[model samples]
Every structure is written in C-alpha cells, then in structure tokens.
Target: MSDLPPNHHADLRHSGPSGYISGLTMIVGRGNDARLVADLADLQPGDHVLDIGCGPGTAVRNAARAGIRVTGIDPSEPMLREARLLTRLRRPAGEVEWAQAGVEDLPLPDASVRVCWSLASVHHWPDLEAGLTEVRRVMTAGGVFLALERRSPVGATGTASHGWTADQAAAFAHMLTEHGFVSTDVSNHDMGRRKVVVVTGRT
Candidate 1:
C-alpha cells in the first residue's frame, strides 16, 4: 500500500492477468527483500507472523520456511490466490494462511501476532496513521514490526505516486515511537539497484 488505493493504479482481480504478472515479478525480483525481512524478524519455531500486503506471499513463504507460522493479508483477491498457490507449491514446514484484507483492517485478533512486516505497501494505505494504529493494536507486547519501501529517485517520473520520501520515512519512524514502539530506527539502504527506506521497531 502506497499513497493511494491499489485499485487506483492497478486492478488486481483474480480474473485478470496483471496480478499474475505482479506475482511473478515479486517471485523473481523481490527475493532479497523478503529474505532480508525474514532475517530481521529472527522468527522462531511456532511463532506467529503476519505479512501485511503480502502480494504473492513471498515473505510469508520465506518466513514459514524458517518454521514460523505465517498469515498473509492483502486486499487483492488475485494476489491472495497467487499467494496460496505459491505457498502450496513451496510447502514450507510451518503453516501458512492467506486472507483478503487491507492494512487498515486486519482480520486477526488483538495481540495475536508476534511479528509483522509490510514491504512496499505502506504508501497505499488510505490512512497511514489509522493503519499504524491497527498494526499496533494487533501486535503482542514486545512484538517486532518492520516496514520497507523503495526510495524513489529524485526527479524520477511518478516518484510521488510510488515511494516514500526521506522526510516521510523519518516521520514514519517518529510515529512508531509515538505509538509506543521502542528502539525505533529509520534508515536508508542500498538494495542492489535501488535504495530502500526501512523502519524497524518493537512494541
């Protein structure tokens, strides 16, 4: 989720081909990002993890492989469908569940998840503050949360429409602190060809 609803840019209905294309792109190009998130999460066996806006369940699959139970949520039906198919194919040791839900409206109960990650999805949230509030509400005490997004280049076309600016990233980190997340940090990293803004914190 970015600054706008996903449907505003791309409608990913299950009957359409765009969702599949997006899923394939994630499978091939976003492996490193997912792995990075998994490593940061340091998931343990039996731990429950949530992947918000889990496009094709790439991160969910990666974390599940580490023996963590995973729940992937997305607003797109096609994306969720693709995620289930991919997870079934991978067959990770831990259980994996997929749900069609937006970041601001999670289906899980409060304090249920031990860890949560949202990659390239924050900007699409209709209400950033509300979404973060929801995130905090669902996470257990001392739970870890990470959010990552591409840092769009300056003067790049559609930059505003795509990713978060440096200042926005900083503000997001501050928001985490205000929401009672400790050890919060916001930094930029060179992720191969592009830079990314990362926000990490613990409840």
Candidate 2:
C-alpha cells in the first residue's frame, strides 16, 4: 500500500528489531575485530554523541567508554529496547539515551551534539539529503560527522550478490558536501570480499 518499492520496507526497517542482534553483531563485530576505534577527531571529554542508525548501541557503548555522553536514535522500537538493556547492563542508570527516531527525524535539539556517527546504513536511507540536513542541524559548530558505508564492487570480494556500484558512493559524497559539511573525504578499499567507503566531515 505504501508507494515505496518492495525493498523500501526492508530498507526503512534496516535497523529494526528483527534480526537486529545479528546485524549489530556482524558490523560491530567487524569493527571490533579490526580494533576500529571511533573517529572522535576533535571531540573532547563531556561531548555529546548522536549515533544515527545505532544498532544495539555498539557505538553508543564505544563513545561512553571514552567518557562521552551518548544518545542513540533508531527507527526500531525493538532496537531501542536492546539499546536500553545494554545501557543499563554496562553503564550507569542515566549514561545513555535511546530514542526511536529515524535519521531524517532525530528528536534531539538543534546543535545539541558534538559528534554524529552513522555506520553501514547509508544505502538504506530513503532521502539522503534530508538525512544529512537533519544531522547538520543537530551538530554543534565544530562537531564531526563520520559515516561508514559499503561501496561499489572492486572485485569478486567487493561485489555484493546484488552487485553494488561505485556510482552510488559518488552520489552520496556529493550529497554530504552540498549539506555544508566541510573537508568531506570519501575512501574506498577492499574489506575481505566487500568494498567500503569511509566518509568523514566537519559541521
């Protein structure tokens, strides 16, 4: 009934409750295996973080371990429930805030956060521009935004079964630059059998 395509629902619910544990385990698992620390960049102690599309609070936990206040926003109630549980398990009672909201409709106040990190969720974004603008509005003047997304197929390893293309990554880079993030940088490389682009910018 929704005018959106069939994949729209799946994509829209990318961070939803169903299979959320597996999803978080897969991506954050990879980050952890590689010892991939966050791109805190210039963030200082006491800075607030907004983890868009935060799946199961991995990034939220990571930021909190660094002494930062973290707020995670996702469209899935199920995912938020897990986030809440994780926060309570590992952090103090009020250490983190988990909100059920989409990237294009974050519930936090404007300029309320010092950093925003979105990982492995860009391809699912319905309106990339609106999502980027929403992130920009919520970031402080010197805040940082780091987005890590899957890139086009460079070889057999980089190729998704659906055959992702480089053109998609390029379009996303243009979108990021147009939304006022300075020093936008996009990099692509082989991650085992997949290509990934790490996009970093400053608000």
Per-residue accuracy of model 2 over 34-146 as CA lDDT, tens digit each: 22326535557778888887767777777677677888887777677777776677884325878888888889889998778776666566667678889999989977887
Error of 1 at 20 (Å): 3.1
Instruction: Count clashes in each candidate, considering only residues at least 3 apart in sequence or on different chains.
Output: 6, 2
Off by over 4 Å in 2: 1-30, 33-37, 40-42, 92-94, 152-165, 189-195
Residue 197 in model 1: lDDT: 78
Tens digit of lDDT per residue, candidate 1, span 114-148?
89999887766666667888999999997999998
RMSD in angstroms, all models?
3.6, 5.3
Per-model TM values vs. the true structure: 0.87, 0.77
**How does candidate 2 score on lDDT?**
0.65
Global CA lDDT computed for model 1 = 0.79
Q: In angstroms, give how far residue 76 of model 1 lies from its true place.
A: 0.2
lDDT for each of the candidates? 0.79, 0.65
